[model samples]
Target: MKTLTVPDETPVFPLRWVVATNDEAAPLVIRLMLALVLFPHGAQKLFGWFGGYGFDGTMQYFTETVNLPYLLALSIILIEFLSPFLLVAGLFTRVVGVLISLLFTGIILTAHVAIGFFMNWNGSQPGEGYEYHLLIVAMAVSLLISGGGKLSLDSKLAK
Candidate 1:
């Protein structure tokens, strides 16, 4: 018989805990952000909203200038318009991400990169060029790798 004392042993990981909690919110938040940003851009291309070059205008650029077939142009438009909706809803996110990433890459090469990094579309001093597209490329890449996360429609659908 003897008095025994047990020493407390606990590990403290504040940063890990923070990241874990933040991860819980990452899926829905990221999907929403991507959807909100992309949907309007897609809408502009597909439906000609906010001064977007409608189907005809886009077709001229695609078929004549870009040398793409009408079918290809239509595919691009459909992919852009539909994928963003699926992305926003967090459905089939990886597939949408892959398609969107390819679309953005084509846009960067065909339009934005030629104007140079710092030049705007109107050839103004402060350019609105490929930088934004590059950023979107990065986001698409992330979504492709990570999937929709725990809080997504993907997860719900899986269940």
Candidate 2:
């Protein structure tokens, strides 16, 4: 004689809907590689370690020497520093991938494209070429497609 009520099965958090699978191995590899490369580069810019110019010096180079706007330099610095941190943690994988891709695009357009696609094999070139940026873009695109892989915080968080 009593009416029955059913409970909703929907999850409260969005990340819960995106379940990680064993197929994430490739993404994991890509993420790890990106983290390894980016972290030290970022450290150089932000902290002056590894022979990098510190924040102010990097800002001057990026803004004055490179002719980038002040805000753009700051954005580049923040993205370089923060993206690697979040990427290593595997948090917001897609967003981080996009940011990294964008940064590489800017680098290619501003600095490397004119030098051509290959590395300066003889070390006589004034600047490096676009090969490394191309590799980063490829890896970033892969991460964007696959999301963070196994052993990532993103995978754990989804659970």
Candidate 3:
């Protein structure tokens, strides 16, 4: 009788099929920067930090002034609060990117477009413009295409 040897195989996960790793600094920096930028907005909306309207105030403003449905108003708050953390953690990067993009799109179309490209430059106006939102969208789209970078939890979990 002849003895046969089996080769070792690495275990695979379903996430491995869906997600890829780059382990590059660009995506990692972008992800971190985006989180740094957006987290403050979330904190403001959720906790009234940085002079932002708290949840109740935002809900009222979105409903009465902006005329958005309550659900949408609430969703904006929750997404703002939650998405940045997930992005920072590098978990569910693609989904979070899409969601942030959508949220910013709605903001641009409904509010910022009318305000123009610059945000009350030289104190000439009362509100901000679409430029910031556009920048956010661009960053998010990049992450959507690339997935999270090397330091992300997504990469670690995939392995």
Candidate 4:
């Protein structure tokens, strides 16, 4: 009688394939980096940190310069500050991400588009302005799709 040898196979997680087809780390990385980058701007708008225009200043810009109503100005401010805080904490991230993504679109179209593509800190020069906002928009879009990761408050709250 001849003995036959059998090869051992490892079981694969089919559910992982269904839920996360690829490495799940990229979305989380984007979330962390974007949160770090964007939150300070929100803080500046809401609280005047990091050389940002605070509420009064932002309201002035929104109303006088941007020609938006006070309600819209308030809405934008609330979304900017509160959403990023939730995003950084990884809480209700999908909702926040979607809202902020919309907010960035409005800003880019209204304010940053005409500035062109060079970061001109001075208002005198047209800038590489929309580029940064575009990147933020991309990041928010990513988060909206991916949701918060295992490292997020959403995950914790879900459990």
Query: Highest TM-score, which number?
Result: 3
lDDT of 1 by residue, 8-112 (tens): 534333222111212355656667787888877778877799789987888788899989989989988898778777876677777777888898999889777
User: Regarding lDDT, does 2 or 3 come out ahead?
Assistant: 3
How do all models score by TM-score?
Answer: 0.74, 0.85, 0.86, 0.75
Error of 2 at 139 (Å): 0.6
lDDT of model 4, residue 113: 82
Per-residue C-alpha lDDT of model 3 across residues 1-159, encoded as one tens digit per residue? 333333555556645633565788788888899999999999999899999988888888999999999998899999999988888889888778888999999899988898799877687876898899999999988988888987898788766
Off by over 4 Å in 2: 1-8, 12-23
Model 2 pairs whose backbones collide = none
Error of 3 at 100 (Å): 0.7
Give a tens-digit lDDT track for model 4, residues 1-159: 333333554443332211221236676687778878877877898999999889999999999998899999998888877775676667766777778789889888877788776567776775457778888888888877777775676665443
Q: Enumerate residue pairs that collide in model 4.
A: 117-128, 118-127, 118-128, 119-128
lDDT of 2 by residue, 1-159 (tens): 333333665444444424332445788888888988988888889889899998999999988898889998888888888887777778888788888999999899988999898899999888899999999999988887777887777777665
Worst 10 residues of 3 by lDDT: 1-10
lDDT score for residue 116 of model 4: 78
Better of 2 and 4 by TM-score: 2
Q: Which of 1 and 4 is the better model by lDDT?
A: 4
Which ten-residue region of model 4 has the weakest summed lDDT? Answer: 14-23
Question: What's the candidate order when arranged by decreasing lDDT?
Answer: 3, 2, 4, 1
Model 2 root-mean-square deviation: 5.3
Q: Clash number for model 3?
A: 0
Residue 96 lDDT (model 1): 72
lDDT of 1: 0.72
